[model samples]
Target: MNYFGLNHKRNNISRDSLLLEIYTMNLPLYDLTLIVPTFNRQSFALRNMRYWSGRDIVMHVMDGTKLGLTPLQLAQLDDNIHYHHMPELSIGERLNEAIDLIETPYVTFLSDDEFFIPSALSSCISQLKADDELVSCMGLSIQFEYKNGNVIGRRFYQSLENYSLLQTDALERMLAHMDPYVMSSMNSVVRSVVWKRSMRLLCIGDLSTFNIGELLFELAVCFQGKTKVISEIMWLRSYENKIIIDHAKTKSFFIWWRSDDKSEDRSKLLSCISSILTKTSNEREMVKSFMLLALNRYVNTYDKIIIGKDFFNDIIVKIWLLIPNNIKNILRLVLKPFIKFNTTNLILLVAKEWSHEGVKTNFIELCEIEKVIQYFYKVEK
Candidate 1:
């Protein structure tokens, strides 16, 4: 009923910004705040800021670089943005720092290079408003990158559709979220109260593996409430892992767990997890069992090989890419019933392969997809 970003009508909107208001549904301006953390990537920071400037949204950008953004750089953003320069902090520390400043009922993270469909976000906000037990809600996420000047992506989660964790017991909810171990649920729109606690442990724990902190976030939040994946397409993630590599270069999995270097942080992290788990199960052994569950799963999953790295069979995908679009569609139809491609088996894939009902036409003409693809096309790796 309301136009997004127009809740407080402007006196005189610029012609350019006026044209960029394409979001159809109204998103409650006060209900959610998107946290974006960036480090050393200037183009990424600017690219992200420019895109969101046009759309009316509340965002808190945490810059970890030693140098603060210049005046001209800050000029590009809008009043909706609250920029903070937090120097000399790890990504985890920056996030841990941002949690306390959140005043919104719902909180979610958007990376400097990622994009979100407005309607998908609105639908998720609606879901959270209706469900008391649901701690988080997001739509199916697809990871994409520019391949030969075209947008290419793949499903980010295995069988991600209609996924829900509504188990009354916190322990049950946490187990289901971890057993399959989807990439990262940290980006999903979550309640501030739950996400804050998760971030507290995540930052203090600072496993750097991303798996433990991420899975622990799942367990910690699910320890509080439920989570869901809606029908709408939510996030368009960048497939580039430069940011991942750069951040993890200093600490590999072994160093974080076995080496004496991370001893104090790791101890603090485990102790926090134990302290939190004790709230659910009073027995020391039970708390230890759950801590072991979180610890055992990620003693070393992606030290040398980042977990984001695909362990799947991609030869078929390579050959699939070599074929023409018509032939690819025909082959996909033929292969549809025979095999299912999951998060494990699929890596960076052609976006056209996963086209939905109305998507067969103008597949690249998706919501903000073209803009994002254009940004990726121009930016350096």
Candidate 2:
């Protein structure tokens, strides 16, 4: 089946016939290019790329590893696969570099440790072909936590039904629920034109924040045309064995707000948002509501991770003092899920939830769960 859960036979047959015709004329099937950015993970990247090399798709590897792909490793790649070695660069810079080289009509980003379901790619390409106005498409992703080459836990992320947003207020709706829409790059495919245009707004020299740039670019693409979400699981993200608390501790929240170098760039990023909002025919009230909602969600999500507790406390105090009581109540309701009594309580809550699910404790059991996912997604080794 395709990413939209449609039977593959219909779509595959047509695509196959077209490919045969192209091959008869000695042409290339370069409708979509998969951009894989790697950093110090040659083995994982090579293994992941090998699976995709078998497919009739273009695979671009932006290798930023310390010790780059060896001659033997380069020889192993298929002809459709292209590799570019560069000195270490930030993820955003690496992505921009890869974007420059995309010759296909559509481009999708994948990390060294991720792989897409072949059927999912085919489905996305078919959808883009059918709709000229569609700028972006995405589906659910299955994430796995592994240790010592063994899967330790699994969770499903970003499950949204097959729905398209083509109205004037599409950007507002997307920003209002940015948590689900602004997902990992692995879960999305975008028209090359849309991607390039969006990047131009974010790529403002070294001031560009990586995480925020990605979110803004995704929003920009959706604002340009129609955006669709498919419910099926189309990507697998592998993570090292790290608990939520550990991950949170290591994460720097709102880098643009905390970093001296990035704090000034925040205005430029906001201006880009304002530009897109102005172009769309959304009302002022709708824009204000969505921007506030998005900001509240963003603040609540990173409250605990922001550089210093004192800074977060000051921000909360300012919010309480400046905002009217009615608005404060509304904000509280919106941020209820993220509101916490204390750090201990939040940690306990997380631990309780994690253990309540009967967390997998054995490698064999983890492998069994992986098998089920592979079977459901029709993934072949």
Error of 2 at 76 (Å): 1.8
What are the clashing pairs of model 1?
Answer: none
Cα lDDT of model 1 by residue, 1-381, tens digit: 112222113323233433343345434446778899988776776777766674556788899889989988788678888888888878888898898889888888888878776667777888888999888888777777666655556776645666788899766665666555554357788888888877776775446554456657767776678888876667777775453443463355545567677777756666667675455545545645665565544444433345435433366567767899999778768987887644321221233344332221122224245545555556744
What tens-digit string does per-residue lDDT give for candidate 2 at 1-381?
Answer: 132232224323233332332212212336888888777767667766766665577888888776778889788778888888886676567777877788888888777766565555566667778888777776555556433423333434533433556565664645544543445333478888777667654554533423355555655566567777664445656664232243332234344455778645654555555654455545534444454456556555556445566788999898789999899779878887886322211211222233344421121212223443344235432
Name the weakest run of 10 consecutive residues (lDDT summed) in model 2.
Answer: 341-350
lDDT of 1: 0.65
TM-score of 2: 0.59
Model 1 residue 315 distance off true place after TM-score fit, in angstroms = 11
In model 1, what lDDT does residue 13 have?
29
Task: Give the number of colliding residue pairs in candidate 1.
Answer: 0
